[model samples]
Target: MIGVDGQAMNRFQQKIELRDGEALFQVGGSVRDRLLGRTPADVDGVLLTPDPEGAGGRLTQAGLAPVVGRNGGRAWRGRGIDLTVWPREPGQPVEEALRHEALQRDFTLNALYSRWGIEEVIDPLGGQADLRRGIVRATGAGALVRDPVRVLRLARLASGLDFQVDPATLAWARAVDPGLAAGERVGREVLAWLTQSAAPGKGLDLWADSGAIRAIPEVAALQGVAQRADYHPEGDVWIHTGQVLDRAAQLGQGLERGALGVLMLSALFHDVGKAITTRWELGRWRAHGHEAVSRDLTQSRLKGWGLGNRVVGWTVRLVADHGRPMALARDGASLTGWWRLLDGHPCPELLFLLAQADSQGRVAAGEGEPSPPLFTAGMPFRAALDRWGQIPMLSGGHLLAAGVRPGPAVGRGLTLLRRAAFLGRWREGEPIAPLLRQAGLLAGRAKG
Candidate 1:
């Protein structure tokens, strides 16, 4: 076990040090975070000892649970520490094991290791210097080829840490075989980057720069697509999407992780259909019915990425109904219209946030500032939703119990009653006979 001169150790560190190992070094993000003066969220340790089995036995004796994986690697978990032993290969020198392990890491910055209770960092791959320079450099040419998921990780690190990718590493990422990475892995990485990063647009920019966006053919098609200059002075569809994503991230800072993910993903693909539906009509750019097209595209792309049904459903709904608020405002839609729109959506608040970001992302022609005219127009409608509850005041069960048959006519009558309630024409707790007569669901009683 390794010991230090004056530094105090936490429980996990103290317990691990009591084992009979040459050294236990804190590795990966834990070491890098400590050097950066940030609190490490998770600490992982690597044990270097000749007796691997002995080390595992000692950890188990200390009450740490052994977690075995499909690959047969053993990891010990306790007190928020994850400890793993490096297995020594047959006929390999023990001295070269550390360097060999370091080379297998995805990036230079993550290859760092620091011995427990010590001030020194083990930099076998020059990771410390790269960290100082704020650069994400791949350890070797085969780094990406070994695990293609590193491509998305490279983008995630660049955005999450606000670091720049080395030019050579970017080129290497572009030249690698795309089929080596699984769609599920890429989707998982993208979701992490979207939800966890301060500015996910930077990660997307890197994805575009590395040519990794081609994995989603629909997203790749967004490049160079034009929008109406009167509304979008931000150049092409891809540029506008990046801007909207950044804006949405800023707007959704305090939201729950799931809501934030939905908003960001919606913003990222809100305009995807422009690539397919854009056309020259009356000598200007127009994308009529693009919202529906975008929704279809979103469903297919997210399904291919292995996203769950709920996420896919919510994201597609957001994309499809993204323009409703503005359209309703333009048409001066009544309270019933707003209620109808909100009734069909899973989360009206998320849709409004996405709409706000969409409105704020555009640079109007001859205007230096981003004008959110639609957001201003939709404010009253949003306030009305808050005044009333999210769901309709009445239900189809009420109509069914009122002697209405369970069929298409009953559904239509319920919708009419809900609309009447929204318009203040119907009151709760009142006799339903009058409303049923108004809805043509009941024969009127002859008055005396």
Candidate 2:
């Protein structure tokens, strides 16, 4: 069934060919998406005719709301399709409009267009050839250098398309000044591009190799700094980070933008501190206390990068608490230990995922044997978490309800009770009565 917009696009295309004696050329991502088998929300059309301005009246007569601003183009929200017009080569028709758009767009692969309801795919810039070859070549070196944002775009296209950038383009991107990219713009684009990747590590490597990684100094510094092979077969903290990013991006597929944003930033900066704290142990290297160091460093970097407080706060929490999972994996750590460590943390699951990714990286790097089975070997790790999820037999809120006065004792009693409960020394269904009695938290329940 042709929907209203599809029908409108059909009608509009035919009328333009008849009245203006010109063909409307669709450009940009709309064309790229169509070739990629995706439906786009809007289409950009370049009109080839003597009086491109008069085409607006005809579109308005066709019952479209024309938005006038930017690009010297009018936006027509009509017949179920939102369309924009870029006038090129007035007094020409059809092919000229297509040619004009191909000349102006940034990348060769993004310049191809499809004729509405026709089987014809236009490729003036060898865009289709680049798409077929899995190559991202710039339309021209001049156009690419005009906007430094293309450097980021080139990175995104290479990752998103899983294509190799042309060597010339890669060379150009590596030498561009960071000042050409506004930090806020880079930040926003990085956050957005992170969503389109299946493996952000590959993307990060591309960024590093292209010098985009150096644009953010703190992250770039992590490269090649070693972590102990006993703990990290993944070679160094930087190498492990790339693997973690790949894992995170894989898991984050289909997640919301906000969730993906958090995950990506967390993956990228999760181990940024290892560059500073690495030291040689008895025989191998170890990054003792790097988790704490990373948390502090990430906070400062995120602030400098102008990231939101919510993102920075959660990422810091994830980085700080990342080591807890390895501790949990150890059979000796008591529930009280786990509970104490996680007492104020947010999003324990995200932390665990990072830990697992870290472990996976180690194993992949031949640092350790594959992790034990999730049921038996992995059970203790999970069981401790499951136990932690249960509320303590008593809390400050519960103590206050039990007639325990609101004082430091109430707070103190809750902590002690929770500690005992976490250790399994406190039984379930037991009220704050016995705990209050023992701690002198209540009059009859305590002695004093």
Candidate 3:
């Protein structure tokens, strides 16, 4: 058994003994973590013995706190420590306590805990063994039945921990009663799973196997659909997705949980429409306009899942332009083509990363080589692509504000400006109004 660290154990033991008369209650995972030789970030405790006098008065008598409940049991100190104290014992044993906590929990792993002083983990339903075995198991018959939110947790743990699900657990999670989980609960849990899992591909597979995928049928359909053998021998659309999901999950650590959350959703949904557009021609499967379909389907799924507007908007942008980066990498893509792809887009680099991961996964499946849009071999093309970020010009909105007539001219002028910038005809910081004027576009005049 790994004993507690120096001074910490002594201090906590002293604190417990000093408060002998008062029942002690701690409300976090620090104890379990400490026993496991892991440094926890939160250490929260409560005085189980009631304070007839008051919260402050009782703490003062124990020489602990004059008013610990001021923050409503939430206080964070140095070293990323967050503490929360409960008012009473929620259940009889640690197992029941876990169930009480599970009422608010979304997954089985998060519900697993141990007694405050006990060395062994109080899995009660064998969560620790499951963790060691790399599988996720539900608590009991009521695990998913009591809270449908747990389904998202299952996905999250599968990815985050790289675990498989027990067949029975998978079956139960699949049969989860809909409408039992609130929209916010579903959104938050799914977002968390997407953002935190270490093997998101596994999570997606679990979701698919459990019927949760059908809840968002558009994404579900991506599985097992054939890809062109010439380009994608990765087995099918599902296998391609799994590769991307695995890569994405490896990126979870220290990531911006919010942005990463959206990125995961983007990655999962990016190829979703390929199934619908799939067609066989000359013994090769082709998915024409799949990118467009994927964007539409992704946005629809995000909205259906009740995701935040910001997440939905970012996801839409990623999905819509996910294929644009390939254009930048492809043969025959001129400076003009590159500029058009980057115009007004904020995340060109991230799009490239996504495209790269997608290409790599595809290549691993013996898909010959990534299709056009990914640079292959051409000195002139390479030079032009390299210079893409250096060029810039005025936007349509700028021309409109300059009194340039709003019409085809706006689009035409913007295109000309971008092209000229790429060709060195328009220098940086040059006023575009004159250029428009040279093109016979009058300021503030709407052309017929």
Candidate 4:
């Protein structure tokens, strides 16, 4: 008899039975997530039938537009449910089909299945036990070798579920050929970990531990790269990056998804240029102009991974300007400086958060205390923007109307005038003509 848990399955089963009397079994993530007390993101089912064509026809005749695959696989995609016919030789028994399908799955936790009206889970691979134990284990021998993409999936599951991978499974993942999967597929897996996991750095650490980081050469190069001890007591660039990424995630808890992704990615790739730009200058390490280098590398690597243009652009901008907030704060820069720093960037708040995280992630040499918060300088700067509004009192157009020629000189002149006003040298009600005259923009007398 169908139970409460099987109500959804009963409806699915009724539809299948009404068409061809075929049995549909729930499987994969749908069963595993539900068993873990988390709402499953998607539901997938397996139709137990030897006649793939007949199953497809029946599903179609039942008014479900099934996406039929070349290998005779069928899928009903709406309502977060997916249905596929079992892969079996013609005339194969349903029991054998179920067993073969479960064995082919990547991880034990994902190889679970349950049928409508059945109280027990159908687990031929001990997936239920693994799920209960909160472990990610391979289904059987050659599991990762069967599909190298599973190596990335292993990291994703570990990060997403906050579970540990079985030692043997990790060993198998380490041994798999990373080149077996294409870059786009591997990128998708890494993207999932970056965007979906609560602690993505842990997933990256697992990937590094499993030697899967070699798949992305850019990230793999971060290992063992030293940093200046005085500024970064965190040992190396790679370790500092992990701390920064986690700190960024913590600081960006309530951020929008796209903004959070950009912030995290910015932290991830912030110091990539340190690997190339590091040099022992005057008996200390220095990475002059690393920001520009890191920005270039970020663009190339993200494009290679096939990320969208918006993401690539936003991440590159963050990487390029990551140090600006800190630098401005240190210099006690005025509102004009802050405005100039945030002029092109759409999310200035995220940049400030990143600066704060970057500051907190570093340690003073031989000290246990956290780094001082440099981003607090943004407070006054933001207050100034809010008080004065984002619009400047004067523009290049004002200079042109004052007889200043339209050229690079006019742009430079207006920049100076704006800085003067932003620094409070010009009062709120003060006329711009006096400032223009003082700057020599006006010829003889100030016009009222």
RMSD of each: 5.2, 5.9, 7.7, 5.7
TM-score of each: 0.81, 0.75, 0.69, 0.78
For candidate 2, write residues 78-112 as lDDT tens digits.
55555556565546556666666666667887787
Point out the higher-scoring one by TM-score: 1 or 3: 1
lDDT of 3 by residue, 62-130 (tens): 344433433344232322223223333433453454455444433455445543444444444554566
Q: Which candidate tops lDDT?
A: 1
Global CA lDDT computed for model 1: 0.76
lDDT (C-alpha) at residue 61 in model 1: 60
**Overall local distance difference test of candidate 3:** 0.61
In model 1, which residue pairs have backbone atoms overlapping below 3 Å?
none
Q: Model 2: how far is 211 from its true place, Å?
A: 2.7
| Each model's total of backbone clashes | 0, 2, 13, 0
The numbered model that scores best in TM-score is: 1
List candidate 4 segments past 4 Å from native: 1-21, 54-79, 88-93, 116-120, 363-448
Please write out the lDDT profile of model 1 over residues 1-448, one tens digit for every residue. 2122223345545555553435677777788887778777667667766667777767776556777551156577765666767765555653466677678778888888877656688888889999999999999999987777787788788888889999999999888755467777778877887888777765776777876676666777888899888778777788788778878998999999888888988998898999999999998999999999999999888887888888889999999998888888888887877887876468888888898888877644454644444466557667757745633566777877776667886878777776666677766766666777766776546121
Question: Any runs in candidate 1 off by more than 4 Å, and if so which?
Answer: 1-23, 39-41, 45-85, 89-96, 116-120, 364-374, 388-418, 437-448
In model 3, the Cα lDDT at residue 335 comes to 60
